[model samples]
Target: MTKEITVTINGEEHTHEVESRTLLVHFIREIAELTGTHIGCDTSSCGACTILIDGKSAKSCTILAVQVNGKNVTTVEGLATTEGVHPIQEGFKENHGLHCGFCTSGMMMRCVELLENNPNPTEEEIRWGISGNLCRCTGYNNIVKAVQYAGAKLRGDELPSTEPVFVE
Candidate 1:
């Protein structure tokens, strides 16, 4: 059976007829044509399909498109403003939070929600917040730094140097 669902995505409203079994990730990627939300794992173990549903981080792969009817969804594409990239995206770029980028989009989306709930998260908190998302390439040291960078920027603190410091 097909169900008609209306969902606002990236600040735009989209209405489509989707099968009851349509996963939110598939609907976003295939029907809505937003491919930033990746499908690394059909299982919810990998958070590559993470997105903000009504300002909360959720694995889109585990959710049905029909379940999100009349709700607001924010993909990684919506994080940027007209001015420039989102602070979280900037953090990832500045700190090299991603190497392969398969998980970067979901990581960024989760960070968005993380910062929303706690503007200033400790190093441990940042790690715990992103524990759900996995990055196969990056060692996660830089990923923690990335979230720290965004926290500083969002707090209006002086931006730290992007250059990584190494002590041998």
Candidate 2:
């Protein structure tokens, strides 16, 4: 059996009929065609399928599409606008936080929530906050720097002059 659900995705409202077992990640990717939210580990261990559900970071793979009915979901594609890229995205680029890029979207989405709640997080806190998201490359040093860069930007402070050391 299928159930109807209406979810606002990236500010656009979408109504669809989905199977009760349909994962929210699949709904966002397959039905909404917002492919930025990846499905790395369907069991939610990898955190690659993270998305903002009603202003909170959630592992989309662990949620059913019906579970998000009438909720607002934000994918990585929603983070930017006509003005420019989001600060977190800019941080990733400026700090060289991404490689291979499979986990970039989830990292950014998770960091968005982290920075929102704690605009000035310590390096250790940043690491702990994003402990769920796994990146095979970059060694997480640059990723941590990227989050720090974003926190500085969000706090209206002078941007860091030093660039993060890139790891192969």
Candidate 3:
């Protein structure tokens, strides 16, 4: 059966007729044309399709489009505004948190919720927080630092140096 559902994504309402079994990630990518939400694993083992549903991080692949009916969704594309890039995005860029870039969008989305809940998360806390999201690149050290950088930015503290450090 098909259902016409309306979901507000990135402050834009999208109404589409979708099958009952259509995954939210597919709806976002195919229907909404938001390709930033990658589909790494359809079984939900990988967090490449992670997105925010009503401001809470969720695996898009595990959710049905109908489940998010009338809800607000935020994909990676929503993270930035006309003023500037979201701190998480900047953090990933400045800290070199991503390598292949396939997992970058989902990783950053998860970080958005992480920082929202704990603006000053320790390195260990950040590690634990992003355990659900998997990144094959960057070894997660910089990902943790990226989250910390975003946390500092969100807390209005003095911004950290974005300078790259080369190890001899």
Task: Rank candidates, TM-score, best first.
Answer: 1, 2, 3
- Span of 10 residues, lowest total lDDT, candidate 1: 158-167
Task: Give the local distance difference test score of model 2.
Answer: 0.94
Q: Could you list the CA RMSD of all candidates, in the order they appear?
A: 0.9, 1.8, 1.3
Cα deviation at 159, candidate 2, in Å, is: 0.7
How far residue 90's Cα lies from its native spot in candidate 2, in Å, is 0.1
TM match of model 2 to true structure: 0.96
Model 3 clash tally, residue pairs: 0
* TM-score of each model, in listed order: 0.97, 0.96, 0.96
lDDT of 3 by residue, 56-153 (tens): 99999999999999999999999999999999999999899989999999999999998889889988899999988888888888888888888899
- Model 3 stretches astray by more than 4 angstroms: 163-168
Cα lDDT computed for each candidate against the true fold? 0.94, 0.94, 0.92
Q: Cα RMSD for candidate 2?
A: 1.8
Query: 2 or 3: which has the higher lDDT?
Result: 2
Positional deviation of 40 in candidate 3, in angstroms?
0.5
